[model samples]
Target: MSSLLDVEVKETIDQKTFLTFDLDKETFAVEVEKVVEIQELTNITPIPNAPKHMAGVQNLRGKILPLIDTKVKFGLDPIKETVDTCIVVIEMEVEGEKTLVGTLVDAVQEVVTVPSAEIQSSPSIDAKFDLDFVSGMFKKGDKFIMLLNLDKTFALDEGDAADNKENQSHAKSKKS
Candidate 1:
């Protein structure tokens, strides 16, 4: 029974549907299983002393969801909201806790099923952008979509550090 269950789990992991989206005109994908839902751009309350990448927080069905600007996180210019702009709500484990984070994308594309076999390891290069956030690359026709490791891409420790620095700055300012 255990062996059968293992095989089933392996099969499930071998191929997964990914939610594709556009960031800075480039295609990117995140595993669909992590996606909670997609939402239209709405009013987000600015968080005091939050990181620059953090767009702010939104009230989602009574829960405050933190929003991350994907373009800013990727070290690109912040996106100018358009009709196509939307948020992809994703649930990820942060510091062993399940957290829901909204990722702001330029636009969302259709979901696509990609086999794990087809994903090629991202090449290590000395680029301005951090490649650790990328899990792999998927080729579709003439374009290659970057597969993002959502967990690593939005690590809570980085946010915490940013918050701490902001708080320290605020405290120093108040003292003056």
Candidate 2:
């Protein structure tokens, strides 16, 4: 029988680095190359007429960056900020434009190198998350980490007038 370390080494020969983070106690990873930086929770200014999943925008350096609540995007409960909460800055192509966005995660975990052979295709099932966003899955010890296809996962489309109006109204209510 092959030892666990041997199996990992064999599988990790052609590995790619990924930055792992926690969301609702689940571990998810994104390619390290796509990640710009990781920051602690910062004040987010609400935006009018934005989508529900949009947490708002924040000033990163001098540039404004749109923030997405990963929990809300996944249809999970909003995160209660703690010391571990962080914002993961990522760059991706959105609507043919390169965009920098911050993703709110429960906690930022360590960077891991996962081998291509270790990744398995995501199963199509009645999962809480849209399986389309999952590129693959791999095991780290006994825990499985879902690899996210950032482009597909963070794709945001222009909203219709009614939806924009509704979001605008919701934002107004929150300010009161």
Candidate 3:
């Protein structure tokens, strides 16, 4: 009886739930623990002098949430807005601070429990864009879902931020 109990506990530990979503032609998954909530695509106020990858900011239940274009971040062209388009609110640790950011995706699919044994290492492909964000992948039927490393995928470099700030200040000074 003890051995059976041990097997059950181990099996539970070995499976992880992931929230899968579509980004263009590829499907990606992120651990559900990091996901906060999903919001339908709404009016996003554009930020002045922001990076190209930043879609803008949205009011998520009175809290301001920064929206990021996942397609542009991955070096893919932005997808047209449709009824299925939505924002995936994720909690990511950036520079030791927990920040809530919304990522725009083509669509959100069902949540799936994937076993650890089925996950494979990221493939070494000569792709146009960097695959450093992908931690692992697993096959589900005919399609494979790439597991994303949240920290790396949504990393904000301090240098880039500082530069942008400096440029903005300089522009303001020039206008004055």
Tell me, by TM-score, which candidate is best.
Answer: 3
Candidate 1 C-alpha lDDT tens digits along 1-58: 4798899788787987899999887899998989999999989788777777888999
Candidate 2 local Cα displacement, residue 42, angstroms? 1.1
Please give the CA lDDT of all the candidate structures: 0.88, 0.87, 0.87
Each candidate structure's TM-score, on Cα atoms with residue i matched to residue i, is: 0.85, 0.83, 0.87
Cα TM-score of candidate 1: 0.85
Residues 129-148 of candidate 3: C-alpha lDDT, one tens digit per residue: 46887999999999999998
Give every collision pair in model 1. Answer: none
Return the TM-score for candidate 2, rounded to 2 decimals. 0.83
RMSD of each: 4.3, 5.1, 2.9
Reference-based lDDT, residue 79, model 2: 80
Preferred candidate (TM-score higher): 2 or 3: 3
The weakest ten consecutive residues by lDDT in model 3 span 155-164
